[model samples]
Target: MGTDVNRKAKHILIVGGGYVGLYTALRLQRRLSRELRDGSVRITLATPESYMTYQPFLPEAAAGNLSPRHVVAPLRRVLPKVRIINGKITKVNHAAKTATFQPADGPRRDIAYDIIVMAAGSISRTLPIPGLTDIGIGFRTVGEAIGLRNRVLHQLDVAESVDDPDLRRRALTFVVVGAGFAGVEALAELEDMSRDSIRYYRNLSPRDLRWVLVEATDRVLPEVGPEMGRWTLEQLRERGIDVRLNTRLESCVGGKVVLSDGDVFEADTLVWTAGVRANPIIESSDLPIDERGRIKTTTWLTVAGVRDAFAAGDIAGVPDATNPGRFCAPNAQHAVRQAKVLADNIVRTLRGEELVGYRHRYVGSVAGLGLHKGVANVYGIKLRGFPAWFMHRTYHLSRMPTFNRKVRVVVDWTLALLFKRETISLGEIHHPRDEFRAAVATGRKH
Candidate 1:
């Protein structure tokens, strides 16, 4: 039975609400509204959240410069014409042309659509490091950002207490592993925030804080060249950050971190921004995937050997044509650009036109180190310090999707210029449980 073209519009279901999914839907609404209105196409975007978080700003969110909510865009507002179904896809029955999803509120619902776009983005890649789930916090989502902010400030609070040097050292020490964009930005931002916050707590000083960054690789930000990584290392070390290259984190017990470099460091806070893996949604689906579990897609964003199905972003192993037997590197720039190509390809497929593949050579790489500092390499040029920082903000703000959001972010920056940054900590949110328990105990005793 072919798709019923006489009924409601031909359904195009997009899974995952991250950069690729949301942008593709937005482009569809902007370009294909006529098709949707004339009963030619019906578009629906099914994602776990109603927003797409611009991940580049997440480290700044952890640092408290950008509001976590501001980092994400509400899908309904951007693509109001498209149906926004909030759910996490568990199974994709491509043969049946249907996908099973567990909604945010309701029971699992099986949705049938004529076409599907698997843009399910990546998840925080974590290893089975002992005591990680219980003692460590991830740096992926807005929730994790908030949690890290709370945890960092809470560590300060713990350090401000009574006279046990051992305990104080543990409270003040913060261990961060991985030197990629996420790790470097996070370490720099959090360290800057915590250092500034010490003024509010008289007992905690900048010297008391021991921030360590461990990277198994020889240097940080492999996306950038080694020269830039060395420059970043210089900048970080200048700010008193201990950047350990060619070092591995052997294990992290209750709070103490053991490095393969034979250094045993004790700390109360351990943040893992190591890396990310493709979304597990692929494994559940009856789709062909590469060894890395990414759906093998052709140059035009079409899944190999699959009909009317497409994928992009971190989840799809797009063949990097230039590098034989290799896939396109996963990053935000590709995800954003790939969305346009993917949307165009889908439209072309609908109209029986020829499709083009997605190919974007990395234009540049940039990283923000707390306030007023950064590094970048664009179009064969490398920059550092204030200029790179300015470029970073300008590029991201321009590419931040909506004008409304861009204005808000720019305004935030302006206000920051006029007023000193706010370093007040909101660390008590995590200790409410302990307070409640203590209150209950006191009442029972009385």
Candidate 2:
């Protein structure tokens, strides 16, 4: 949608820049370039950022195993023909077939579109738990991953410098709330990295480090089945990880985690990765949403009751045909598969071809347990330890989208096999403005 245009090839406006949005855009970009009848198909992707952060690599980014910069794709670079606007869609008027947007640095604007794809993704689902707003670190973004790394490294410094045992203990203890992929893998990878890092620091040993995982549910990685969940728990327990299942973080006033199980632990780090809810922006849009606040979509990925509107990913509650009883789970695998289907459906609608329904079975789940240990259950086959870990890397690498990116990621892994993991922390970048302000204030005083 733009200032003036005879709608050519039926303009496609994709909202959101996360998994579903990016994948859909990528596929559409290639398809449009190669297959479109007359370049009549105009694609525009509008989102808050001109980049897409690969969420799956956040754990590796947190552990400093992968550079955070390597986990993002610049939208403009990947899809040159596609108009990439840095903005957020504030309203969607399906009746008029238009969306209102607020740009990064301009007046508000309206976009009239022929077709709309709402992939506005999910946000970190947070509760009003005491002190969570200020203390809990989210596990959804690359920035948070880099921040967590700095905090972990600095915590090691705190442990080394402090003479008080209690202070050292508090600094060394890292608490992660949530046993999902983000929390579990982050805890595992960081713990593994930190344990390896102790050789450089004479004051701390692997035994001195405390890694705690607290989950409200009775098990971790529930998608991997009860057996796998139980097995994963045992593995964590065997590594001295204090996994508190059927427990909740009641309060964390002043870095002390008070659990529902009537136990208390003090730690400087609190990571929140319990789950994600639809992005709050959807609530403001003129569309029907489910009880959980997700856009309801049919088997064909069209907005359940709205014509010309389609959505996919975490924000869209897409009905699962294979299961027939539930919505598609908001995981990377589903999101990737749904994007392809959603893109094809959009193109189909433009070409006057019949839109096909989205149908795919759950292809099992995988978890990387750090330092070359892993767990996975794919197509009814279960794997654990090194085998599972190898599969985990392989699956994610293969599914990493572009062939160019795939090669770069594989190169990173190959280099990692030969060289030691980089433990350098870039904490300074987080507070560049603060340092400038302080320097200016001090200069005035002088």
Candidate 3:
């Protein structure tokens, strides 16, 4: 009877191995001493990738300041005690305490869990625009970031080799939709890289390149206050970047961008980093969610109307304790902090201890505007240029997961200081199957 009961260990299954999932599991694995040793509790983490991407480093990665591998932490290495299942949870039945998981190449399977942590994160929230599918690329994943870097460099090469004015003009132009941190940082980094790489090509110069940032809002970097936003706009404009404020992308058909403000332009590259929506998997779950499709949670981060079900990070609509009638903004700072509190509360629930509410005030924002230039607003004190740039790097370096990853990223930065940033475009990395397809065709012909 004792063995039978022990065999039925309470399984804590966490979906999405992003910020919340990794941090929560790290805490639980360290805290679940007696429960784990006696087989009374077990933790499992399910995610599409075996690694977690440190999204803040994406801009730096694209600029080749940090290697792509250093920005991602492998789940297996980080969460050794927890069962790392490489899959995605398609649906959740909280009433039954079971979830349906689909592996990369395997059939669907039902996983029973005593506790569920919904941290599936968010996906790029895009609008319905013509040719968006064909011409636009998102800046959410590491693959996308690296691909964008290669594509930008390849366009430089294309412009240098081509004689046609139309082709050269299209190849040299780059359009970025959105003025958020991701969009702005990506644009700045890529543009800086292109500027540095201009001397390598005889036909391509800084004048031949056109980088445009389109934002529907009147100001950019709204997280950094209106004053700072305007300062950033002026800085970008001074750097010859076209900052289109209060503008929206009407269409992007065949490398032609039609703006809502009666402007039309041709560009070969269109990067979309407008916004993100909560993972759609939350809707399929039998849990209380807000109108925005995020799991409705109390201040303590427990799922409302559901027992043993909790959520944090982007997927959880956690009430803002500091401000009533509002929810916490979905950002990395809140996500990482909430994961810690949520883990403690989960342990408290198991021990029948009191739970504490989660509350955090907005602590301002920081952004990098190309190399050695940035903007920051922390505790109402504003900073710009190299000081903000150093703060941006220092802050993210400290937040990056694992000592090993930190060392690797620092090494990449150190090497960059000693050597110039590599500008070669390895475009074939994305099309790994092309060689196989060509080989198959030749074999059939023979």
What's the distance in Å from true for residue 359, model 2?
0.7
Tens digits of per-residue lDDT for model 2, 1-446: 34434565577889998888899988888777754447677888999987888877778877766777777888888877788889899888878777888897778878888889999998989888998887789988888988998888888888999899999999999999999888899899888888878778887788999999999988998878888888999999999999999999999989988999999879999999999999887787788899778998899999988888899999999989998779899998989899999999887886789999989999899999887898898999999999999888888877775677777777778888899988765688898899889999999999
RMSD of each: 2.8, 1.9, 2.6
lDDT of 2: 0.86
Off by over 4 Å in 3: 1-7, 439-446
Off by over 4 Å in 2: 1-9, 34-39
Q: Per-residue error at 41 for model 2, in Å? A: 2.4
Error of 1 at 324 (Å): 3.9
Clashes of 1: 2
Clashing pairs in 2: 9-40
Candidate 1: misplaced stretches above 4 Å?
Answer: 1-7, 428-446
lDDT (10s digit) by residue, model 3, range 39-89: 888999999999999999999999888899999999999988899998888
The lDDT per prediction is: 0.86, 0.86, 0.91
Higher-TM-score candidate of 1 and 3: 3
